[model samples]
Target chain A: MEPVTTIHGRAYPFGQKNVDTDVIIPSHWLKTITREGLGRGAFETLRADPDNLFDSVEFAGSPILVAGDNFGCGSSREHAAWALLDLGIRAVIAPSFSDIFSGNAFKNGILTVVLPQAAIDRLIEVAQSQPIHIDLDSQTVTTPFQDRFAFDIDPFRKTCLLNGLDEVGLTLAQGDAIGAFEDTVRVERPFLAVGVGS
Target chain B: MATTHPRTLYQKIWDAHVVERRDDGTCLIYIDRHLVHEVTSPQAFEALRLAGRTVRRPDLTLAVPDHNLPTTARRDAAGQRIAIADRESAQQLAALERNAPAFGIRYIGDADAEQGIVHVVGPEQGFSLPGATIVCGDSHTACHGGLGALAFGIGTSEVEHVLATQTLLLKQSKSMEVRVEGDLGPGVTAKDLVLHITGVLGAAGGTGYVIEYTGAAIRALSIEGRLTVSNMAIEHGARAGLIAPDDTTVAYVKGRPYAPKGADWDKAVAWWRSLATDPGAVYDKVVVIDAAAIVPSVTWGTSPEDVVPITGVVPAPDSFADASKRDAAAKSLAYMGLTAGQAMASVEIQNVFIGSCTNSRIEDLRAAAAVLKGRHKAPHVKWAIVVPGSGLVKAMAEAEGLDRVFVDAGFEWREPGCSACLGMNPDKVPAGERCASTSNRNFVGRQGPGARTHLVSPAMAAAAAVAGHLTDVRDMI
Candidate 1:
């Protein structure tokens, strides 16, 4: 897994609030048992619109997305995260995100940046024409229009993103603590102890 | 002195999250938002006392008395609640109101505009957000995870966990990715897509895994559509389902009453962004799906996997391949009165219902209303009701004249709440009657014991209502 710190990727802008997963990957696509071909189904409904963001030649192949408020608001389907990833989107800029979608996105290395709606509007305006810079170390999304917006990230998640760490990695980082706690707890609460053969 | 030990995210989040832990492990979980309804809370609060515990923090928890709230009240002499068909259950509701304030859990008793399904209210209210862990006694607890929180449905024992500890000790599972890519054709919905996935993966395909749904097709859906997809994860036997945070996510939460504002808002968004999965991150398993092949789907039996698109044929019992599978299939079809080679859309219904946490929002109602407008319910269809998921939904729906649309079509415009989803109240299917519904689960007694259910989307339900049979929503479109 590659840790994301700074990115210089092309950007695509979608200006809408509460864009749901059904719009992204729709319910009909849930039949298959694999993840390889879903990119085609991404934004199936939006794709129906000839002028949809994903279909626009200007933003074709762009890996960064800037969106309006309340993005990814519906179900906890992980496919929403995957569709974006497969479409070559490595990062998303929005005013907000669905809680479960964010976790799923992080696990897949999609950086979801929450900026002010004003910053997002600005980015959306610039994304259609120019590239944007996202610096994880500096925590900003800068456009050529002299606009630089700062954002915040939790230290733990920041560390995880910079190191490509997931839940298991976070646990592993505190491996000694877990091990020591288990050992001591076992000795103290003998009845709770069991053979951990592994 | 007690040691100042580090609380795990489970502990830290739970503790700081808790306004207070009540008797035993029951803490408020500092409900940044609480969604409640008529049926479950009465018993839950009753359990609190039977166990001698009081609600620790009312501000953190909110309640809505739905389920039993009468939809026909508007037609009544006073537009007040129609007396419960069962007086004893009415007594239980009385106790809920009397006890809510004593325990400090906010209760939007019947007639309160705030009441609705506990599952739908949190995200709607902006209380559910990324990185938070939410617990609701309802199996749809997983629904709140749509907001990027570590949310899950818990049993009664687990509800008590929140009532006391405001935290849960969950063993992390091997991560799995279920990716959906491609463009779904017109007439397809998230509901059809999830049902299709479960059909192939089998009902238990996701056993013991935390599924991370990724792909272009998934990221493109609306919040309601995503909920429909993940809501069925439990049907696949997955522990939970999740999506990534992005612009669409943030935009949904902004302007909601409780979302952070100013500098704090900036902090929350930044932290949320960093939580996305790492690129090239390894998972225990990964499953990718073709979005283009999906069609409007419907379930044929009790299990969610027993499904095919509206245009597809009924599956033969033998097609199950195993005797048990075949027998189960046979029994479900026998109960449903379906035959192999029978087109799924041709099935008939005695009634049609369009409401539930699964598909009873403004959009859902609107979709159904669009179809129901300028049409009348089929004579063979005895009942067609549109129940909003919450009181707020009812108001919004009524504001849009959806109620009139239903009434004009020979359908009942019922009050907001889970009227027939679980049959915990009087609104339910009569014995031996088959109805097209828009709720989750079709187990033998899911809607009501011996009450046959055929799940469909709201638009499909509306279409079926007009046709007096199960029909493809696309046909109407």
Candidate 2:
């Protein structure tokens, strides 16, 4: 995981709503064991159209994405996040997001920004022409058009992202307490620990 | 005198799972059971390997290959391994088989008697227990919550986290109580209840809340019926749904293979009984639905909320006051190739799939069998398939002759493993074809690209197969 504070770059301005994980990366693409090189399959159905926004030259290598409400609405597949990451998307701006998808994106170092529909509309227009700036420290998204929008994120998640602390790292930080709890369980409820490992 | 707050079932489970609470409000909660399937476990294993971390509690984890196995046996040369038609599906399943043993996790794979959809096998094998914290990589993990567990879905990253630590960092969600009062009329089923609830609450209605289903209607349902209701909770944007355990749940759990025996069993039951929500517990939101008002319903648009009774007609997009909903309805209608104001019963369907985590249990099979017996599928119905929830379910249904009833009625009685649910396996509703499905989601292309899915109950789906179109199961009954 990488620490993310500010992501300033061109963004894909596709503002489609209710964009489910199935559409983000279809089930067929999930058959692979490895998560690498999924960008090719990311938005494959949409990219089939020559005029699709994802394949447009203007948004090529964009580090940000602006989407509509209820983004990533279906499925708990982290492949959606992996696909976006592989496609060079570092942040996503939407009015709202599916909680599971948002959690996955946060763990994978992708920033999900929630703003009002008006702010999103402005960002979509600005993203089509120029770059958008996202400053996590300031909790604001800005464009050269002087448009600025503030957002809110859980303080815990913001700290984890800023510190590059993945779940493994965070859990390991509380190693002593977890070990003690395991010891107590071994004594108090030995049955819970049994019947494991076939 | 100190006063203790009355806690809902969700709050009790959440409070019990908390290992440590941080000042920032995120808590590291213990996970008692972690269910894994072929589709989502591969990357998580890879992540574990990269981090050089072994599973911390392999005993608490159960691995099954469900999403990829062929429902119908396929043979190649030696016939040692069931032939998987898709290369990626085969590779993914093989990866899980290889990985599970190395991690010391219990792996049920490839026609094994215990093998089935992860959600089905969890409860079937007694791995899902009351007062436990369960997590799976599949959204239908909520199915286990019917047994009074706090079960929900996680992603690959969280899967890896659970593998390494048997815990997850999460913020507690608000709680909602969906109270279904009164008894369901004859011909009404749990599938109908969930569909009706989804219609009342829309796709995003339960967002940021864990739902607890209560009231006379819920308590009257059989254990299997309760599972079906909880299984579709994710369809309405809830991460999890639960029904507190009672005598019905106790009866279902006792004597199961993994269930505790002797003194341990007594202790387990006592603890499970205590897990019920305390009386007078308050919820963030309360929704009361009259079970008598619910009829056999089906989805018309892509969203599950875009539904009506089988006797109803497709709604015009313009009927919606919200601009976005109207736009979505229009797009869904176009994609589904449905006309506004057309009778739902008149809409013909070529494929009928009566299996999924949501409605493939023994009770669901029996319900469809009752409708299919002494009848035949309509000539125009291209494929009517019945897949059981698990291999054990298949064996049990066969023992009851439910499979024969379906087969005699012109429906294909296939093996288990989420067949035709998401259409990732060989069973798929072809593009441009419409299907009467008992699965939960009605999203566009959920069955297949350009495939239209009409969500219904198992009996309703059976009725459709016989009528060659969407028909009211009440009429057939």
| Winning model by DockQ | 2
Winning model by TM-score: 2
Q: Taking the tens digit of each residue's C-alpha lDDT, what string does model 1 give over B4-52?
A: 5532222333333433344545443333334444444544554456446
Each prediction's whole-model lDDT (CA): 0.70, 0.88
Off by over 4 Å in 2: A1-28, A39-164, A183-198, B1-3, B74-79
* Model 1, CA-based lDDT: 0.70
- Across A64-138, the per-residue lDDT of candidate 2 in tens digits comes to 999999999998878899999999999999999999999889888899999999998998888878999999988
Report the lDDT tens digits of candidate 2 across residue range B151-259. 9998778889999998898999999999999999999999999999999998899999999999999999998999999998888889999999999999998888777
RMSD (CA, Å), candidate 1 to true, equals: 25.0
User: What root-mean-square deviation over C-alphas does model 2 reach?
Assistant: 5.7
Interface RMSD for each of the candidates: 19.4, 2.2
**Residue A74, model 1: Cα distance from true site in angstroms:** 34
